[model samples]
Target chain A: MLEKNKNLLDIKKLKVSFFTEEGEIRAVNNVNFSIPNGKIMAVVGESGCGKSVTAYSILRLIQKPGKIMDGEIIFHPADDKPLDILKLGEKSDELYKIRGGKISMIFQEPMTALSPVHTIGNQICEAILIHQDVTKIEARKNAADMLAKVGIPNAKNRLDHYPFEMSGGMRQRVVIAMAMVCHPQLLIADEPTTALDVTIQAQILKLMKDLQKDLNMSILLITHNLGVVAQVADEVAVMYLGRIVERSDVRTIMKNPRHPYTIGLLKSLPSLSMEKTELPSIKGSVPSLTDIPNGCPFHPRCPYYKPKVCDAGNPPDLNAVDDNHDVACFRTSQIQNEIAGKERCRL
Target chain B: MNENIKNITSTPLLQVKGLCKYFPVFSKGFFKKQIGVVKASDNINFNLVTGETLGLVGESGSGKTTTGRAILRAITPTAGEVILNYKNELIDLTKISHKKLKQLRPFMQMIFQDPFSSLNPRMTVQDIIAEPLVIHKMAKGSVLEDRVIQIMKKVGLKPEHKSRYPHAFSGGQRQRIGIARALIMNPALIVCDEAVSALDVSVQAQVINLLSDLQQEFGLTYIFIAHDLSVVKHICDRVAVMYAGKIVELAKTNEIFENPLHPYTKALLSAIPSPDPDKPMNMNISGEVADPGNLPPGCAFAPRCEFCVQQCEQQIPKLKHLADDRYVACHRSWNVEDSP
Candidate 1:
């Protein structure tokens, strides 16, 4: 059963499709996940794996030709009422109220995220004034405070600077400050640190984690870095071909991955603990959306693929391996054995 | 330690010393002319031994990519010598003729950072992989096609998929095509510039493994340039940490990770996000990297270094051997305790 403790965001069997010239591309295929109140859940995968599409589905920001074909995106309001974000009609007043006030999203590219013409201060204050009933002067001060809260040095001076005048790290902080200015209950950050250097990335991740604790708001961090998930996420959902292949607590997933794809991913990562020998790579690439194989989409790359069960038919529904851990692989038991065998050989 | 030192002395395939590449900065005014130079690489020194992977890790504008490009002669260097050991003869790459340079290019190939833009989108995968072979005049006619198919299979690509264009493949598959092109030459030294940084973690592992296996098969030396410390730690035999067009620290992979000496190197390692969420973030350094064009008089990192003393700002530090093979360019490396 889904947790009923006033979950912040609950997505149920959400299906998203893109009506391309070739055909309908199922970007998100029956994906289900939930963010408990005041927790971080990371949706992780490589490019074209539909992690970003799922985040866009939450804010109804999917572009033309892309539609949420099926399922519900339920958001529990701060006032304790559940609203289906997918049901909100276009350009409705209710949609506008939740767009920037209750649910906020930060995009990957900061240059595009912030308008080039407007100063950062004006942008943050605009978000404040759009939602809250406040004067321009008061909104400006609130925006500056939010900037200061995100660790932007000399926030007052930076308020008058445009996006081009600031560095990449500073521009990203301004975006984060703007997203959190309204005290949104749910924040979605999509590959927020992908464009930043490692040092700046560490700083931003620390800032986000600190803010999450202070604000007690739920965050859905979408990134391809498993190391990042291990650092910031309490729970993680490993996505492949727009579906959740594995979901578990961060520690469990890192220590003992069940799905073959997840296991291959862990082995492929070049860790400091690994020796200078050849790295273990998954043999094949992710199938393109146009040529997604029948049955299991990951069967080709699955190391534990049993032809009759894995290739010919869909794996059983996500089976509970433990409390709060679920995997969609039919050969979870065999895969675990193989992983353990590999570890023994490694030792 | 002596084994690695012996390894370095045994036979260096490529030896680079005091390599400097400066781009003149021009301004438009009453007497507008070349007033200064952007020191992309300043008196950089390193040697690539045979069958060794030297990882060059640095932030953007640190000159890691420039160092790799200059070694390959992709861009002409302003000064310094590149002594390449070709068949037991040390030939200066800077002094080579145009035709000779073309002949030598097959021995040293470069794998670019972005696979999407690096590969020719207009060409089919077969043509993309076979370009290097054709350019080097290594194969022709049906022989070239067979070689291309063989290289594709070696890199985990299906031979039947060779007719498809780059747009039909994913990021991982496109990278494979890039690898096939780089490997088709059977070069002695391959410079992988941010090769895996553009990939997903899962796909990055596969590429890293493929690179390692290929290195063993061909006995190739790699100048692996990337900003990711973890990946560098896993693959590199030795690492050279660069800061503002200079090698600040050079040591074995474990030595550099465990005992990073330069202030810049220390800051870089601390900034790497540890996988453990329970452990608090250890990075305390602040402010963005200083502009490379207008670096400080002494150490470029002194402006943001936490342990900056009066001496640090007044005089530049020189690279000194701290151990048998470890080198550091910091005044405080001797006395500073482990901060990470």
Candidate 2:
């Protein structure tokens, strides 16, 4: 019971910023969340909402001009001491060991993620060889086994094929095999199935779920599709303009979203059941990072935008509204009362 | 309500019969032998009435865009008959000469998928929207600018931003620019091929509402081609499900969603992850989409279908009309419930 309640990773007060000629762009602002051991947590947001930046900060992969301004990423390994990943030096061997051995990432485009010159067998074997002290022949055998585990038919024969020779679905499977070959504790999949067809998307999603359960690994899935979030994620974090607006279990969040941004996102989605003539859309678009709104970033487009209360003060911090459900909204109590009042009226 | 009833009984605006588009592939060498053909559009048949939207949905290589382009004569089809009802006269678009087609271009237009590459970066927004008008000698000078501004405002763009280039606008605003360009000609039929696929969901809803409003105000017909099922369902009146260059099913929007007959259609519908967690998705269909250049014998979906029989492997099923205008192309679609 104690093991089930342990967190694999904890991110607190993370702030990532990009310095450009214009000004400092706050890509990820004070985001806080924790992934429980052997669970799937999804960060849901639209483009330019800084979900990708938060994922990159976990691996310390922020490039030039983009700096991790302030944060504490506490990684709780099963058998080792909890290490603050941000405190590790740029060239520390411990960081290298944790980057790909303890944690690995899978990108959206499989073709670009893989090397075209080398065979897939060599790519997968390289990952295994880097972390494990094994013979070349043993690494090859392990690569073939991993390929077969990912549902690749004729895995042994297909090892010699280059990345370009395989189809999109097959290449994605190879990417997954490479990411999972080292038996990492945490897997960061950034829109992993966005480039594939819907049928193939379903197949890849099912395979990922099966592998996650079998291997006992946590996944930080970053995606914009609400449907995908509902289908896979155990918990969800709604991000808007670098802030974690809401966080809760999947059922609680999807059934009764608290934040106005979350409500707008859910209402905007076109579902199979709801076919109204006019889908009520959130007004305006996501503001540019450089020109973010003063107080709340979502104030410009939020339907419940109050006059000075919402646009003149500092952004609201995340607060608990229910068990394990948190919302960053100043009007949470008022909204709750309004909803209860409407329900009573209906009855 | 009476207007919708009239639209149902009205004559079709466009009729596509036996459309087939094939691109040849040659071997690499001195002796270039014609190896095979990519059947992009294989015997497609559909009809579009006025003030109605017909959705063409499929995967990436399922020939949704090819059918849209072939209908507009953007690419010459290998063999087909595209008959357009122009001013109470039936005119065959494929048989018409190039000069004659140019004159008829004003009635039909197309909105491309990518707003970034589709619009010219060098041209200002005003010029980009007015290029169609300028080419057809419809308007000029201040009159053209006035028309452009009017259409831009209708699509929810500001008049002062007309002189700015596409790079200055957001993705949603750029898509609105693309829509304004397609609507400036006052076209009767617009082939919107994945128009809103590139925008974010919030912007997608805004554009969809704008499109619905435009359709009602102008009485326009749309051949809406896309892969997103939920978006397609919300906007389209009828839907035709395509697979491997062939439409396997064509029916009303609600019928296709509620009572899907084809195995591929069922898999496609089930594959769409619902926003609700209570309804868990169980998509059992396996294997990738079939290669269009080298399709197998009989039904192209036979290899992946769970309900495939020996007869399916031997004979290709013709699209037969089921009850209430629902057409299905499966040998055993009628008995899917019993078999499964």
Candidate 3:
């Protein structure tokens, strides 16, 4: 059952570009998605696919040479009215008020995301005092409690520990505690578990899921692992060359994947059945941003690429394949047939 | 049990017995000396048969990488013996002289985890692949270029890419260049240390396939080390699970996945997110992996193991054969009849 909270974040046609010396590289191209209150939406894609850029664009964290060229990021904060996040400058006091106060982000690399010199407890308390009008003593106690809530053992004792003092898993938990101390309405986690081992990765993922239930905050999870998306995501968006090729419920995308890129990703994963001799991989690499193919960005590696349509012109936006399922492919039927054929033969 | 030992009678290409590597922590004092030792690998024993893949699966700082480096003689081992069977003659690699080791280096090669760092930045792909050949005096002149092109083709690279440097290629293609260099020696055993873990899922499959095909074609054995269980399952014939510095479990790939015996292996397998969205994951393991330097008294995993008992904390479990080819290092393996 879905939660009864209102839509906390609405993003429409978000186009982000980077002014590189080579040329203007389009990192996020006309991406559109929304996160309902307490829901987790996963954006899955390979490297250089703009999943991270989309998350950064929402928090207005895009650095120099990169700008949100067009689109709207309407965030209806829990305590305040709706506001466009893109219009707020980085140094503006309004943005500083909302950056870590209303919306928090957990980066991929814990070592770099955290300050090397500051204690983990101080970092968490800093977040708490920045947003909430809390005293230093209360913030320290609250930070310890938050750390304990994320399952960090001896949290009170380790309050003075630096980032290097803890293991990767513990450091990540500290990061999560800092992000959640503010009780933000929307949390953006970019590849949170990519650097951790499988066991630690599972623990962090479960912590995020459980915290979402208790805190009732929407999450925009950006990752490249389809396995992770299957576990924690309610909705899935497959990105290719900065465009959303498919967006649907986790079940629809996994069970009936329509886009060729998504299908290729699923096929590429090694299964436990141990029956197949060789894993089937997509043919080629992602085209460079400066040398993006004309029509479909995935045509070079797509196995079911049609000659005239996929090569001559761009494919349309996501068309509804089912009630909540949408795909942006002109040859979904043919790709589905190919996937079914492979499944039948394997069976 | 005796018959099982007898079944492994063939001369292994490489055999490591009681291998241990300890790094000494030196302080700047009047008599600067070894203060303490970081026991990276603790009495690890394994045998790699010719033309078979032996996967080494472990978490970070588990000594899996150290074990690979010790086998290649890249780092000096504090104690132990490494025997290599070259052309039906047993050669003790541990006691060999430095000059002789250099002569013997051509037959053994390693593929590093990151392709970007492994390749030379200033050299072309052709030069990188042919460096081993030139150093070993195997080929020169146009023959070296032809051989480099040939090996590149074998690894799914075009001949035209030989002149380009490693920076010009993608991660997958750069890994292919690393593979070409490793295979150029026609090494009997190749140690792949997290070789494909740095690649994309789709690109990982391609490199794995190329490795397997090369293995079949050249009768090459591999000590494939990785942290990903699924990738290890696909490429390895037998797998070893490591914790801290000890191998906790070793079994056939199918047996290890189907009937995992060790508690740590069970937790690891259960933690891997299955692609089936309808199936709810059994993600219930608690506590983080303990630091290697400050491990528990007996079993390194006893602190995090849910099935730990008093005996587990007092006595270190020895790796023992349980079934036909399965080996597990856990005192509670007999108590837990089946793994869920």
Candidate 4:
């Protein structure tokens, strides 16, 4: 029932696994989501939840020992026919053009992304030269313009400054400038502002939001901070142990979460609005990938764990709970009934 | 070891006055000429009451960690007095000898941030927790092991996992082991330096709750140092907001959150992105943190503060008592409007 042109990227039954020495680590299992054109979609989760791995699979950036077993990553450009990114050859020019020209990704660490030896101007100009047919001088000018647009003061002189010469916030701004210099259609930002201070983080988030609007680009934002998602994202998907447990608009997901894991996560976050002596914590920590329990990965830490119902059968699928909200819990109906009963008893 | 010492709670458990720690910077040459000094902690003054948690909130390089280390005597301060109430007598930790400090080490312990790196990966959990008891000669072979198990159980770790190395445990479990190590000595004051910042969200909640529970059960005092205001609000009774080696604001937790006076404190509070979609993110202050090596002549935050005036740019402000139990270091605090 979904329209073809509305979604810029669609991930269908994507299954990614890492074959380690011990065994197969199910990094991403049967994940499904879509990034609509010009929309900011956030994938929120804790560590080892496969959110980064799922984002890495979109641009075919998964390295050796990790295989995209089966799935289709369809990309719909404005003027061209839809193409499956996963089916493209590794070294093909089509993939190369799409990698930086049509789609760009920013990593978690800005220091690692930019080379310390090369000047920032050289680094950013290199990105522009590879994707477009521009002269060296033109690329240099474009780099300065992009840097200025990202709120870097004295962008012209900053061209000669190395990555080490700038602060953490400045280096992050340089990374964003490199990612957005080519004006790509889809931007994948993974924990973009996690390393920065709170003031710097606000500036960067505002920069990203402004850039997204100016360029009319779609963003697949991956982060562990729900506050950032609430501030910027339009859609939210909560990931746990390689599966999308819940998906809805940001308001609905934050206000009326259906999954038990989502509820626990919201409750556990310390808020500034109220001071609490004891925060309601989830029972246990996230299990390692190799030692994940069977039948619903979150069941071990879930508070509403039943003996045979939640811990039995295969993991539930992402079923439609409402008109737009989706939840991957078999006990959604039971949990709702229990909540209603509690309300009646209180009344 | 003595039950009578616990009943006396007349005075503050710890008093830090004019604490300053400076590190000399050298020029890049063969001679290594002295260039300048980085005033990491300068004139830090506070009195921590008995069994109360005092939070030290600041950004990176704001000298919160240095202040914590100076109070514990882990690093020698440039000049200051860290007075602690021990055995119904006041003792200055800074003026003590190395051997004397070692004897007093068990009374004050620290829990570092990064649980993965804080614990000894080569040693088992039991050995790590019992090393304190062994060094102090408090217990022998079996008794030491028993004490370790008891503390581990108190911190919510299973006794069966005592023999496992740190590499086998999860992040949250490893943090529990860290807590057990800090709690084994029954220290009167515990310095938690971003103890819960490295954990996941759910695991962070667990550790925060565990810390409060331990504080209540033992009547322990804490100097909680972190940049996460939400966690500080939940756990701290009072908070001291540090900026550029200065205590910009010190107030009760509720007052600091609801009615911050200093410009830096207000900016920090507004900068926090709340986990609610209804609230929009707004940051009026701009620019990066001031450099400690070459701070401005006036207020260090004048370059980034939105409410900057000529006085703020020319003269530094002192931490003055504004109202009931509220201290703020701002030139225009008297004229600044209330929070919107």
What DockQ does every candidate get? 0.66, 0.83, 0.75, 0.80
Better of 1 and 3 by DockQ: 3
TM value for model 2: 0.98
Candidate 2 chain B — worst ten consecutive residues by lDDT sum?
A: B1-10
Residue pairs that clash (backbone atoms under 3 angstroms), model 3: none
Note the chain A TM-score of all models in turn: 0.96, 0.97, 0.94, 0.97
Give residue A62's error in model 2 in angstroms: 1.2
**Across residues A1-347, which tens digit of lDDT does each residue of candidate 2 receive?**
23433899999999999999988999999999999889999999999999999999999999989999998999988768888999999989999898888999999999999999999999999999989999999999999999999999999998999999888999999999999999999999999999999999999999999999999999999999999999999999999999999999999889999998898889899999986478989999988888888787788887777889789778999999999999998889887788789899999
- Backbone clash count for every predicted candidate, in the order shown: 0, 0, 0, 0
Question: Which rank order by TM-score, best down to worst?
Answer: 2, 4, 3, 1
Q: Point out the worst 10-residue segment of candidate 3 chain A by lDDT.
A: A1-10
Model 4 CA lDDT for position A220: 96
Looking at candidate 1 chain A, the ten consecutive residues that score lowest on lDDT are A1-10
Q: Which of 1 and 4 is ahead in lDDT? A: 4
Candidate 4 lDDT tens digits, A176-212: 9999999999999999999888888989999999999
What is candidate 1's lDDT per residue for A231-327, written digit by digit as tens? 8898899999888999998988888778878878887877765667677878777877877776778898877777778776553567789899999
The numbered model that scores best in DockQ is 2
lDDT, candidate 3, B18-106, per-residue tens: 89988777768888887676778888887878877889999998999998999889998889999999889899888999999988898
| TM-score of the second chain of model 4 compared to its true counterpart | 0.96
Q: Candidate 1, which segments miss by more than 4 Å at Cα?
A: A1-5, A333-347, B1-10, B28-32, B136-138, B276-280, B338-340
- What proportion of the true contacts does each candidate reproduce? 0.77, 0.81, 0.75, 0.76
Taking the tens digit of each residue's C-alpha lDDT, what string does model 4 give over B205-263?
Answer: 99999999898899888999999999999999889999999899999899999988888
Which segments of model 4 are wrong by more than 4 Å?
A1-4, B1-10, B338-340
